[model samples]
Target chain A: MFIQQLINGLTLGSIYALIALGYTMVYGVLLMINFAHSEIFMIGAYIGLWALTAIPAFASFTITGFIITFLVVLLFSGLLAVSVEKLAYKPLRQAPRLSPLISAIGVSIVLQNLIMLFVSNQSMPLPEFKTTRYQIFSAEVDTLQIFIFCFSIALMLLLNLFISKTKFGKAMRATAHSHSVSQLMGINSSSMIAMVFFIGGALGGIAGMLNGMYYGSIKYNMGFFPGIKAFTAAVLGGIGNVKGAMLGGFLLGLIETFSAGYISSQNKDVITFCVLILMLVFKPTGILGENVTEKV
Target chain B: MYKLISVLFLGLILIAGCAKQDKNVIKVALAGPLTGDIAAMGQGMKKAIEIAVEEANQSGVLKDKKFQAVIFDDRADPKEAVSVANQIVSDPQIYGIVGHLNSGCSIPASQIYAKYNLVIITPASTNPKLTQQGLKNVFRVCTTDDVQGSAAANYVIDKLKIKNVSIIHDKTPYGQGIAENFKATFENRKDKVLSYDGINTGDKDFKALLTKIKTFKPQLIYFGGVYSEYGLLSKQAKELGLNAVFFSDDGSSSPEYIKIAGSASEGNYVSMIGIPPAKLKKAKAFLDTFASKYPGTDLQPYDTYTYETSKILIDAIVKTNMDKSKIADYLATVKFDGILGITSFDANGDTLNKSISIYKAKNGKFEYCE
Candidate 1:
């Protein structure tokens, strides 16, 4: 039972990591929390649902089908993120902090309602992706769990390489440190900002699609709670730090599933948020957050 | 500034002047969850009421009065139900109301209806407290959860011969009320309940809870919740190899439940307060007419009750002077044998001779189990 719970935790955690990376990446680059990223996750999930329903060859579970779904969701989400940043966030780039925050919230509402109006408000049971369970060490683990863990890890590693080993990655880091400084260093800061939004959106989108596949259901407001939890993961790991976000997502997921299994199932959500509150209060800089002086 | 103010004042006057009123129109409101998870049930009820009204209007029940069906989507929320109740009450043209399904919504909204002397006949809400609150303005065509719960318990314990039964509710009034009633019946009969628990509405994940239930090794898992929650619960339980015989309440008697739960829902039982639509011999013509008129709408059990309720209200309006108190008084004493096999309400506004029909899921459909 405990091992089974851990598998559930790992599957849930990896999805959270996918979304948390988005929140962390956006905060990393623009020093702005893209609140609408969760809605982008929802859009991706809807797209994944439609895709599943449309494709006859991918009716049941296959690794190739899953890969196709992930890639499709990733591309669409990246494009959506870039478009959102260009239209809503860029206009308020020089405004007060509250202004951009309000704009992000507006974007979130518009996206959620638009989907509600066009698609359905009910929970859509995504087309089944069947997999056989294997008995291992007094526990049963399924192919879906294994796939989620590996896929999330692979994406995270790919993202790490992109950020560290590529010129675009260096520009993103440099911009995060100080936007004007990176601009002076000949980086097209606007396009760099858009790129950061795209990557964050893409990761969050894939996370949403993965979430639909994992749970077998998706609703209009499905992203709200996971979005808050992922944001909590971002904060717990260190808001501006990508590595911290990944660690925080897994830790939170494990904590949630174990507590639900061992403790009260109804109060699992309460316990999760309590952990977030305690971490926020005790370690404000998060596990990997570094202190930096203001450049005023 | 003076010219702009004059323009705004003229626009307000124009809006006020355009408010249309027809003296011969008799409006009856139908409020329920037109959107959200349980939308299919609400929409089914709506179509039945609309059909009932259209037939009556064409037949000239009131001779000169033309009936208009006013619909409102309360989304099965208590707060929204109250707001909808208030909205319909404020509309003086509305003669009666047919619903606000889901007892959680109907119970709260019933208070506001009583205050304004508005008549509301709920077709599907089964919570016992709804009619027991002594609200004369409120009536229901279906049996209460107390009756339903007892029937289901008797069927499970005595007939099915299930001993170690587990009870789970969705924590809402509709879910929790029926669950409590089921537990009460079990306690009276001295039947063993292995475990009793609750889950929140909108909860899709049930693996953690299912894993916990596995330790108990319950012979029967009786869930008092709607289809959306139970669909996931049953599927997850199957996935975890719990292997318990599943029993659900009327809340999960829909074909959608089987579709959502897939192969896992096969051979499960669902107990509803009334006989299954397929079994109602008197309702076959009504069902055929409904299906022919509305090509795609599934003729569900609640649609029968809604059809009966609409006919009753229309019949009452034809006799009464379009007064709320008169209609209420008439409804209390009225006896009719229509779609639901001799419909009549007791002093508490609950239907007399309540019967619970059991259904078994097979081949992605709910089949009546006689």
Candidate 2:
């Protein structure tokens, strides 16, 4: 039972981590929270659900087909994120810091409503994954769970490598440190911001697809709560810290699953938020966050 | 001389307005969750109400008096329901209210309706306490949960012969109240309950609770919640290999449930409070009339209930003038043999007909079961 619960937590944590990566990356580069990021995630899920209809044979539950559809959704979502950044956030970039944040909120409302107008609130059912479950000492783990965990971990590792090893990565780091100085060094900060958004949006897209597959249902507002939870995870790990976001996501997932399993599912949310509050009070910098002064 | 002429003109205008009162316009308010989570139910009911009003107008049921529906979205919230009730109360044109679908909203809004002496006939609110409160103006066309729950329990015991059952509720008045009734009925019937738990509305994940429930090894799982969660639960339960038959109330007997649950919804029993349109001999023609009028609207069960409720109110007004006490008296005694078949109010303003219709999801739709 404990092992099963752990697996459940891991599956949920992986998705949270995937989404939290988006929040952490966007914040790291732009120093602004993309409140509409969740809507982008929801749109990705909606597109993926539509794409499933085009591939009727895949509706019988083929793993390869699902992966292909996921890639397409990822690319679509990345492009959507870039366009949104250009339209809404870019104009507010030179304005006050609070201006972009407020703009992000407005973008969120617009995106959510637009999607709600297009898509029904009722969930759309997905194909079944009748993949075999391997039982280990009275605990069972299914193929989909394994895929979600491994796929997210692989993506996170790739993201980490890209950030550390690439020349563009150095340019991104340069901009994050000092935006005007990085521009003086002949790096277009705007393009770097767009690239970061693309990567983050792709991760969120994958998370949304995986979530839709796991739940066998997708709704317009499905991404909102997960988006909020992932944001909490990002803050808990240390906002603007990628590794911290990953850690926080897993920690949040584990806490939620364990609490729901042992204590009460009804109070698990309360517990998750309480832990976050305590973490903020005790270690405001997050687990992997460096000691940095808050900017006025 | 000019001032005297103006005074005479004003007096003539007043007399003309009194004569114009011949064309009576009675506003009937239908308040529910029109645009929120339960908007499907609300929108469906609205369409049904519209169909009823359209037919009434076309047939000239009240040749001189016109029935106009004033719709409001209560969003299934009690506070919003009170506000809707207050709005309806202020409107002198509003003669009666057709709904506040959810018990959470209706139970609170019933007070305002009673206070304002506005006759309310709920098509869906089934909490027993709503009608039992001695509210004169409060009435319903649907059977209460107390009776529906017992019928469900009997079906489970006699028909399915399920010995051990576990109960789950969404913790709202409609869900919790029905689950409590089911529990009481189970006790009365001497059936065994392995475990009972509550889940919140809009909950997606049920693995934690289901896993906990699996330990009990219940033969049947009774979920007193709406269809949104019901579909997800069906799918999740299948994934977890729980293998227990899912039992639910009328809330789950929607096409949306089958749409979301897919194959998992197969064999699950959903208990509706009244007979379905196909089975109801008189309602079949009414349903056909509605469907032909509104091809876009899927004929959900609530449509029939709402249609019948509207007819009852209209017929009452048609028989008696738009008087609250007169309408209440008419509703209390009148045997309304509408499309729903013999809807009459009991002493406490509850529906006299308390038949439960059980349905099984087969081939992606809820089919009636004996």
Candidate 3:
């Protein structure tokens, strides 16, 4: 039972980690939280739905259609995220930090209303994905759970590779460490920021797709709860630390599942939040986060 | 320019005066949770009312009179319900109301509706206290939690012959009331209630309660909660390797539960008011019409109720000679054969006879349990 909950927690945590990456990545470079990231996540789910419904190839392939639909949705979502940053976030980059944050909130509201205008506020039906369960000594696990955990780990590994091996990744790290120094080093900080948003948005899109598939339905406002939880996960793992966000997501997911199982199921949210509050009060740097010293 | 402006202003005044004098149209207000967690029910209700109004208008039951339904989305909040009620009351054209879905919202909103002397027929609000206030204007088409609770308890005790049961509630007015009523009914039948507890609505975990429940070795667990918590509870219970009959109330009517819990929802029973969409003959027609009108939308619970409420309201309006003052009196005596069933308001304007249907999840579908 414990192992089963652990697996379920990890699967859920992976999706949160994917979303949290978007938040932490953007914050790492811009020092601004994109409040509209949740909306981006929501749009991704809609795009996935649209792709599945509109594409003839995907429509006919009932069993394997979801995987194809997910990829198409992820691509579109990444493009949308990049475009949003270029149009909405880029113009306000030179302005005060508060300006971008406010604009992000405005963008979030607009996207939500736009969804309401187009999609019925009702929950959309998800294309069925058959999941086979494998029982192992009092624990029954499903294929979807394994897929989620493996896919998330692979994405994170690839992301780590991109950040470490690629020029853009180095530029991002440099920009995060010191923007002026990175600029002096001839890195295009603005373009790097855009790239960060693109990467984060792509991962967020994947997370959105996985969430819809896992939950078997999607709502226009579904992004709010999971997005907030992912943000909390990012903070828990260690904001600005790539590995920390992943750790935080899994940790939170495990904590939530266990809490739901052993503690009062009704107070699961309370328990999760309490853990976050305790962490913040005690170990502010988080499990994998480095304690930073400010020299004035 | 000034002379033209003066002429335009005079024309507007004349039009306004003429519009005010014309009493050919009557408006009915529909208030419910349209944009929150329970937004689906509100939307279903709204769609039903829309269809009912359209059918009534087409039927031309009221000679030379038009009926309009003004919808107010309360988002299931009591505070918003009051504001919505006030808005509905201020509108002189509105003769009747058909909403405030949640009991918490309905209880407070009913006062304002009653004070304004507007007859409010709730299609979905099922709390007993909603009508027990003895408010003349407040009427409900659906049976209250009292009937539903007793029905579920009786089923568990008589049919299932379950000796030990665990009762869990979501801690809301509807959930807690249903739980308490069920507990009383079960206790009355000499059935042992192994455990009784309350949980928050949005809670995702149930292992602790399940652990306790497992230890108690109850044959059945009755959850008085909405679909959201029930889905997770069902899933977690299965994951924890606990096999027991899980039952929920009307709030778990949504197909979303099956989607969320997957195979885990199998064998779980949900007792709900009115016939499920699959069983209602008129519901099929409504579904067809709704599908054609609003394509690619999932059918939701309370859609038939809303349709019936609107039909009843229109029937009352037509019978009352289009007089807003007499509409409430007419509604009290009106018998409406609507999409759900033949709905008639008693002295308290509550539906006289209503049946609760039990649906069991089987093979990833909600199959009607006989």
Q: Estimate, for each residue in B1-370, the C-alpha lDDT of model 3 and write its tens digit.
A: 9999999999999999888546877787899988977777788888888888888888887768877778998988889999999988988888889887889889999999888788888888888899889888788989889999999999988888889899999888999999999999999988899888777654334555665566677889999878877887787677556788899998887887887677789899999897777777877887889889889867777887788777778777777766777877776776677677677777776798678988899988788885
- State the lDDT of candidate 2 residue by residue for A1-296, as single tens digits: 78878887889899999999899888887889999888888888887887788778657557787777888899999998999899999988889999989888998888877876777755677666676888876666788889999999999998887877888877777777778998999999889889988988888988888888888888877888899999999999999888888998999889988888788776788888999999889988787778332110
Residues A1-296, model 3: lDDT tens digits:
56666766777788889999898888787788888898888888888878877888787656688678878877888887788888788899789989999988888888888897788676676676666878776566778778888989999999998887887788888888878998999998878877888888888988888787766667778888788898899889878778888889888888887787667666778999999999988888776677331100
TM-scores for the candidates: 0.93, 0.91, 0.84
Clashing pairs in 1: none
Candidates 1 and 3 compared: the better one by lDDT is 1
lDDT of 1 at A249: 94
Residue pair clashes in candidate 2: none
Q: Of the native A-B interface contacts, what share survives in model 1?
A: 0.30
Candidates ranked by TM-score: 1, 2, 3
* Best by the DockQ measure: 1
Reproduced native contacts, each prediction? 0.30, 0.37, 0.27
For candidate 1 chain A, which ten residues in a row score worst on lDDT?
A287-296
Cα distance off (Å), candidate 1, residue B108: 1.4
Winner on TM-score (1 vs 2): 1
Residue range with the least summed lDDT across 10 consecutive positions in model 3 chain B: B202-211
- Give fnat (model 3): 0.27
